[model samples]
Target: MKNNILFKQQLFLVLTAIFFTSCLSNVDEEVIIEEPVSEITFNVHVKPIIDNNCTQCHSTAGGTSPNLETYAGVSANAARIKAEVESKRMPIGGTLTDEEIQAISIWVDAGSLNN
Candidate 1:
């Protein structure tokens, strides 16, 4: 009877260890989640506006301030860019429509993607 009890105890311990180990392994496993980032096309929406309004003064050759030729350049100056757009300080000689200003603001807020 003592031998049977000892065998049962040993089996219980082994099963408990296996159950605990499996639980621990599952706890350590990693779960991945994929999120899609919205893409903003630069040429279609952003470029024409800049070329028509800003390039005259913001270009490298013009030397009005800084050149806004690329995405990095624009992103680096996002705060100033947004402020200028919001306040209608850009396209210096003329005013931008509310929709145009809002579009520029949205683009900057959306991570200023080059796409």
Candidate 2:
């Protein structure tokens, strides 16, 4: 009877380990799909992101430098904007979602078009 109990306990431990190993082994890594750069334009995608996350600090009426209130300002500073947001360094008090950051990156990659 003692041997039977010991064998059952060992079996339970082995089963638990196998269960966890199988579950964890099936976990998938996150994949980020890049949108066509042409589909991601300045007005349609990038502006709203800037408007929501950046304009509070970088607006025309605000005290912040490098105002993002216009296309020209944003397009001109596209590289800096992409770098800062990608590093999660800008916006100071706010956050940009992965999707928003991706949009900004693609926009910059597409030559920071005014469209």
Candidate 3:
């Protein structure tokens, strides 16, 4: 009788442990995942800066020749834009702080999402 009780107790303990572990594993799997940072919309965030600063000289009718008004335009010229931004050559004659430059660079590096 005692042996039977011990065996049952052990079995119950093992089952309880398994139940708790399975619950924990499910909880872990339920954790919400975040979207990739690169997927963020550049049109909404980064374009405003370009519009305010570079567009005057770089737009369709501006001195810079090409217009960065649309995604195709911007993506096509991403390399040049990246070079100028990386070299701090853009926003010519105007000053943008390091933080602003970093933001622009990050947006570009993030695949320039159109949103």
Candidate 4:
């Protein structure tokens, strides 16, 4: 019957509206996805790089350049350190990997945090 078909179409429209409304209502307002920032600490990240590559010649005992035994010492020459490392000038006959240099650069840029 025509009436039966009309009723079925109306019911289908109502169901679709209800379905869409429910779906829209279920959406969250603010979805904050906090991405963890990998912090570059002096003792944890920067110290290891200096110890591995720079301390051999930049230490207090038999070092040729400035002392890098402490955070203060390293921070004092942070600019020079960045320049030399970037240019591959220091470490004498050795070399620092791109990752290592980047870590150092990041540390310096982050105010050379002692952590």
Candidate 5:
């Protein structure tokens, strides 16, 4: 009876260890890597930033600031935009991420293409 109890205890310990270890084993982990935007387009990339940050004050109708309402308007002011955003000057009420500033710089450097 003692031998049987010892065997059962050893089996229980081994089974518990196996169960816990199996539970702790690594399942497949999904790591998503986002590739940086190599080509930034005005309509796709710049428009959102301008719409979110500038349009409230600089829309075509308000006219207090330059109209950032269209591609022509934004392209014309791309250099200024880059400068202001780089210096954290333009968003007046808020701020942009470094990545956002870098994207604008990259877009401006790439000729502020309308793509």
Candidate 6:
């Protein structure tokens, strides 16, 4: 009788471990489906981020700034823009969404085209 109880307990523990392992195996990993970098453009995508976020202090109107309000200005400093945004250093008093930062990064990676 004692051996039977011990055997049942060990069986229960083994079954419980198997059940939990199966449950863990069924859990799906989260996959983010962001827009392709090729789909990101300067005029439509990057401009909006720079206009709404960066222009606050990186424009001609902002004084002593890099003039991030225009295509030439943004393209000229595309690498720096990506670096600053990735580091969360720009936009000064405000914040940018992950989507916005990804857009800027994609634009720069796509060669900072005028489009």
Question: Which residue pairs come into collision in candidate 1?
Answer: none
lDDT of 2 by residue, 1-115 (tens): 9999999999999999999999999999999899988899888999999988888889767769799999988988999999999999987988888989999999998899888
For model 4, the run of ten residues with the poorest summed lDDT? 30-39
Clashes of 5: 0
Candidate 6 lDDT over residue span 1-115, tens digit each: 9999999999999999999999999999988667987789898888988888888788777774688878988899999999999899977788889889888887888899998
Error of 1 at 82 (Å): 1.1
Q: What's the lDDT for all of these models?
A: 0.72, 0.91, 0.73, 0.83, 0.84, 0.87
Q: Which numbered prediction scores highest in TM-score against the true structure?
A: 2
CA displacement after TM-score superposition, residue 46 of candidate 4 (Å)? 0.6
Runs in model 1 deviating more than 4 A are 1-40
Best by lDDT: 2
User: Model 4: clashing residue pairs?
Assistant: none
C-alpha lDDT of residue 7 in model 5: 100
Return the candidate ranking by TM-score, descending.
Answer: 2, 6, 5, 4, 1, 3
lDDT of 3: 0.73
Candidate 4: deviation at residue 103, Å? 0.3
Ranking by lDDT: 2, 6, 5, 4, 3, 1
RMSD of 6: 3.6
lDDT of 4 by residue, 1-115 (tens): 9999999999999999999999999998965332222577788878988888888878877557698988888999998999999999987889888777878888888787778
Error of 1 at 67 (Å): 0.7
What's the residue-level lDDT of 54 in candidate 6? 81
Model 5 pairs whose backbones collide: none
Could you tell which candidate, 4 or 6, scores higher by TM-score? Answer: 6
Q: Estimate each model's TM-score.
A: 0.60, 0.72, 0.59, 0.64, 0.65, 0.71
For model 5, the stretches where C-alpha displacement exceeds 4 angstroms are: 1-38
**CA error at residue 13 for candidate 5, angstroms:** 66
Prediction 1 global C-alpha lDDT? 0.72
Candidate 5 lDDT over residue span 1-115, tens digit each: 9999999999999999999998878567766443355667777778898899898888857675688888888999999999999999989989998767878888998888888
Clashing residue pairs, candidate 2? none
Of candidate 1, the 10-residue stretch with the lowest lDDT total is 32-41
